[model samples]
Target: MRHTFAELFAPAIVLVFSSGCTVGPKYQRASVPTPANWETPQPWRPSDPKDTVPKGEWWKAFHEDQLEALEAKALDANQTLKAAVARYAQARALTSQAISALHPQMNVAPLAQRQRLSGNRPTSGVPITLRPVTQNSFTLPFTVSYEVDLFGGRRRNIEASEASLQAGAADLENVRLVITAEMASDYFTLRQLDSELAILDRTVATLDKGLQLVTARHEGGIASGLDVAQEETLLRTTQTQATLLHQQRDQFEHAIAVLAGQPVPGFHVTTQELSGEPPALDAGLPSDLLERRPDVAEAERQMAAANAQIGVARSAYFPSLNLFGNGGWLSGDVTKLLNVSSAVWAVGATAAEAIFTGGARRAQVKFAQAGYDAAVANYHETALNAFREVEDDLTGLSILNDAKTTQQQAVAAARRAVDIASDRYTGGLVSYLDVVSAQQTLLSNEQQLAAIQGERLVTSVLLIKALGGGWDASSLATARIKPTIKQALQP
Candidate 1:
């Protein structure tokens, strides 16, 4: 029988067009329980639904220029973040590789060789005389093969890869969010140390003057040696406190340096006390905002990929279709290669069905289903945690804000008591012990205020992180800056 190339391929071409379908189940986001009746505390203002999470340059909301600069450095140079980006690139490459399965693969080989027939070799017991013959062989050949996606197994693989790539992207964004929040927390903590150090220094200076006063009064016979000794001891204790604060501040400074990807030893932050209250944040209901978290988005994408894998597993039960073709020119004379008489060609199509596998294919289907169920559970767990975090931060900020107000009043009353006690002591109306107690109370109150203020700032950063720092899943698929692999280098 004689057949034209088109006629030989006609059946397969028909299958490719007429029988293509995806057997895999369509992806649906699993239902998760969202926290209902979420309330925004009085001091925290509610925002537009669209502004659920903190948005781009969210750190700028704190109005700390140094923090903004440090964030930029981390984004550009942090080793952990760079590693995540490299992983995303690798995932993207895998996706492209999977998509390549849908199209034909072709390769060509050019050959030049010399061959000889041995005279000593038996020639089927022929009586004719044997002779040595040598010749040059030149050939050019091309081979091509393609698997038809008649059952869409290849397409299912592609779907899984693409979903995994999106998940990789979301993971990168989650890493970014964590790093930025950590840096913010560390920087504010350093500033908090600065404020405490300043408070301790003031206490030390005031105690030094009190020591001088008590010593002079003792020499003038109006005070006893005991008062002078007690005053000196108090001054030394306050000095010790200031020294300890210095050590703590240096440690926090080192942390900030590391966050900025700089050497710890030489890096220095000028002494600047933490100032002002936690900046105002856009607050809202949890249901409207939970999806903004990258971790949540990553989990959802994981489920999607697993769903596609189920389709891939089921697809293995259907028959596979493939087409193969090869053509070449061959001749002993190099100049005669590619001539019509030297041409050779072949074409074929195959449909293969796996009749048995000892239940391996069925097991794969069950395994894929289990994976999807696990992914759904993880997604729900993540969502629940997100809600919990928001509630904790909101309540924490509200209580702490109120506490700071009461603490400021206590500091003021303590300062007044110290002034009154000093006056009474100078008039010899009371023991020096009274003045010492009042001074200690005043210093303690001031230090407590600084500590509380620092906590407020740190808590604010955590709250912003909980709200997704203005990042959302909408941009998870677009990806950051990347160089494209051109067509020839890619699929």
Candidate 2:
């Protein structure tokens, strides 16, 4: 039995592809030295029996309902996160575009034309008069083409595109981490301000009663007018502080609104006093950062992409093969366009190689290698920065915890002093200025404690972000695959 040209070439094509001559060095992750333990000693250890770090919704560790809702809303509505997600989608599309080179490309074109030939135009060897100058022609053609990846340049391109998509996925996770952490930080700060305002409001009421008492005493010729004036001045000052706290609260509220992708005028969080200790976060071994941090994962994926680009560049050193086939029907009678008598077809192949281009190809290979090296360096830098962040937050939380303890003691002592000073002034043993000083000291201490608590919460969120915000590197493998609709919906 006779075979068509396509059938005859099939075995040769398979043999060439099966040789698997990938042009560049196989990819291996760049080696990075990591410490066996974190730089800062952590009081907390991973609760998981497997010693793995947290994954998925790390914010739930705080156990705050309002915070959980805010984080959820931010994930759903944040514009930055939406943009990152769109970029990931684009990367996935580009990867598919690159992969398309691995398969045959088919397209159809149908043509109908009427044209007139010039009667005076030259003909082959001898001139002849043109007859029936005007004519109608109709054809419908189907063409298929395939590039045989003999040296794997197109394969490397697909590899690079897949790696880029992985990097994009990691970037999306990083954005989600940032938005959620920002929302939590802003929420905590706003709550802290609310607590401070409540403290000031209570202080103002106490001063109000003191002012009335002193005013009555002055009118009865028992207390001096100077005492009444001092009490009034302290009350107004405390009120001013309340106003300041409200101002801070307003700013944080607006920031939270932006994070939640809501209009500032429409978004409002009810006044809830700050009340929570920073949850203990486990700092796993430094090596864990390779898998834990999304930024680090992104850096590593980009390095892989750059490495694949080197392969693509190196493959340019070899020749390329393109196979093409055309099948069509042509007839003067439009109704007979599909008839066997009207069939026309062609099959062919082209081999191309760049014999010389100065040093452009060599320079491209060098440039790709340089890019890979840079990406490797960036990966290392990202890991080192992650370690530094975890250390900073750990130390800050530890010191802040101690400072909060001391400030609470100070607040207690200041409260006792205010009580004792007020009794002494009532007994006419000291001027009311002593009581005012004690009250001011107490308010300062309380506000300082609240501020420290807010700092600890913010640091905790930062630490979570630095540690990779509940995403693990293992997910990169899954991300390389086209995501299902359910997976696409995930934040």
Candidate 3:
């Protein structure tokens, strides 16, 4: 018995030490090319190199206290984000479970039974006899089973699970970034509507006063009925515009309510004009984008997981070793079950080799390798897309900046023209039609300016989002809510 135990334990120790070799190809991160400088022309480069937007708080740059509060509320209450968090936790638990395969499994069994043996036997050289024997038996057994990871199959599985968990965490961060960006965009849009509505209200009031003056002049026989009719037409048009603005504002208000995770009827945001300058974004070099972007990180993690899966698949070509042992006592009587004299022990080793698989094993290995290749390609593509988004936002910001400047000048000129046309018509130097045309031009330019302002703000938020919401390695480690393996394993 002692010799048997020694032999079994020896192979287990050897197997433990030899489980270090991981089969299949080692994973090397695919290199991504970085551009030296932004392609877009800039009026000013990053002004403060040291003053960067911190990870997880990029939205604070807008300097809107209300926006910050709404973002916080969404992060806490949004159902989609909560589901992502739960999925991350599940991945973490799966990682832990995969790792546990490297350890031994143990179980205990205790049994008691009473049996009666009836003897009516005709022995080879003896006469038949009838008798009954009663006996009580008790047995306590225990087992220890350990799978010897001879080819590192279990280890590779654990590695894959760990990488998957990391990907899940990155995905959760991505969800948060998306949610925050959406909230900011919606909030800014609602504010833009408020500004437009305010403009329409004032325009309507001004047109009404102008119509009253024109009517008084017609009553005094100084102005023709044509002038009164033109004035009335302008007033009605401005009122119609105000009605349209009100409808737009109401739709945006309802959207904001949904984004804030509130019932539409219970949620309300007061009409407030958009007043702040667009927050400036400091997009670092392209290489920085790869490290800072959560989606890119997620893709890299997926590649790593695929690489590990290849190892797991290749391990199937080798033999598997397992060690099983049990030691306990058995006695005919319950009173003597724990006695040393009733001791018993057993230990064994099992080795299995897949001699034939009809090509299934080879196919699996090829499949795993193919998956790894696909993952690498996907990761590279994701990185490229991230760069494209940053470049596009940068170009958009530069072009929109120039457009805003031109539009501002145009608005000023139109405003001045409206004043000149109004004065000319009152002095009988120009027709009422000229005044109407000037007012329409000014109103159109002002509306375009409002839209441009909203675009600038929305683009700024999008740029921040593309930059991965300021996420970094440090933020991953410091997130307030972290996924736990134990929490994931719960039923």
Candidate 4:
């Protein structure tokens, strides 16, 4: 019996050693065409390549202490981020479950029964037969089953599951980037509104004083009633604009509260002007984008998982090998269940091959291959889109910078025009209509300048988000938590 067992074990050992070669096509990182430099010139040079962007905390670039606090609060309290974390946990659990397939499964059963034999059945062979026999028995049995994985099918499944788990992690990071960007945008927008409101308030005050001057002049016969009415009209218009700005500011405040995971009714931010300059960023090389962007990394990982699925599908065409064994004690009497003579054991190997499946295996392989192809395409597309976003944002920032410069000059010129028009109207060198036109131009230019400044800041945040918010592949390497296969299979 020992020799026979050795022979069986020898063949199993050989099978295990030979199973290292996986059958399906191996995955290669898809090749993509990338440019050496961005089409738009970067104002800032790249930072130290060895220096890492603080992972999981990219909002500190704004240098706003309040913003930093708000981000920490949002990370801890936001419902959307919490949901993402839950999804990541679920994926990790699934990965562990898949890895468990590499190990054995065991079960135990303890049972008791009572039975009676028919009297007529035992009397056939005997000339004189007695009454029916009644018996009670108890048994304890243990069974174990294990798949040998001689074709690497289970290993491929495990690899796919691990890749999916990584994808989930990337998705979670992507969610964080999006949330932070949105919060920053809204915060800056609220500040812009406050600035606008301040400008409107001052404009209204000046217009009120002008209205009084026109009224006094009309009483002295130096100005007409029409001039006073126009001045009043300007004051009322400025007041109306201030009212609209207040409404906008309220809405933005409510949005910020929601983002901070606070109740709108209980949350409010004090009115403050947007005073910070836009944060400078070093746009890295185009090639580095593949490793830096979270969504791009996610797409690549999904492609790897899909490639592994093809291996799993192709495995269906091969035979499966399983080993099973069970041992127990059985007896007619419960008290005699532990007797050595009552013991029994079983051990067996099963080999199953698909004889015919009406081309189902072929169809499955085709489907899996198709899925892999689609994933590859999606990965390439996502990478390209990421590149496009960076380029577009770079171009936008450069152009907007120039626009801001030119618009500042325009604002200065408009202010001078307003001052001169006021002086000319008092000296009767120009009509009151000229003064109104110059004042309107000055207000519009100033508002545009404020809007452009806010937009530049918001776009910078978006650019940071597109760059994966200072996260990269190195972060992924450190963040990975290896899963245990053996513990997961215990039953």
Against the true structure, what is each candidate's TM-score? Answer: 0.90, 0.91, 0.89, 0.93
Per-residue lDDT of candidate 1, residues 25-70 (tens digit): 9999998777665564635555545444457767877888888988
Question: What would the per-residue lDDT of candidate 2 be over residues 350-452, giving only the tens digit for each residue?
Answer: 9999999999999999999999999999999988888889888878877887888898899999999999999999898999889888988988898898899
Best by lDDT: 2
Assess candidate 4 and give its TM-score to the true structure.
0.93
**Residue 489 lDDT in model 3?**
40
lDDT of 3 at 5: 71
Task: Report the lDDT tens digits of candidate 4 across residue range 268-383.
Answer: 88877778877777788899999999899889889989999999998888888889999999887877888999898899989999999999999999999999999999999999
Instruction: State each model's CA lDDT, in order.
Output: 0.84, 0.85, 0.82, 0.83
The best-first sequence of candidates by lDDT reads: 2, 1, 4, 3
lDDT of 4 at 356: 97
- Candidate 3 clashes between residue pairs 3 or more apart in a chain or in different chains: none
Model 2 Cα shift for residue 226 (angstroms)? 2.7
Across residues 382-490, which tens digit of lDDT does each residue of candidate 3 receive? 9999988988887888888888999999999999999999999889999878888898888888888888888888888888888887788444443223335554443
Candidate 3 has its poorest 10 consecutive residues by lDDT at 474-483
Error of 4 at 184 (Å): 0.8
* lDDT value for model 4: 0.83
Q: List residue ranges in candidate 2 displaced over 4 A.
A: 1-12, 43-54, 116-123, 126-134, 481-491
Better of 1 and 3 by TM-score: 1
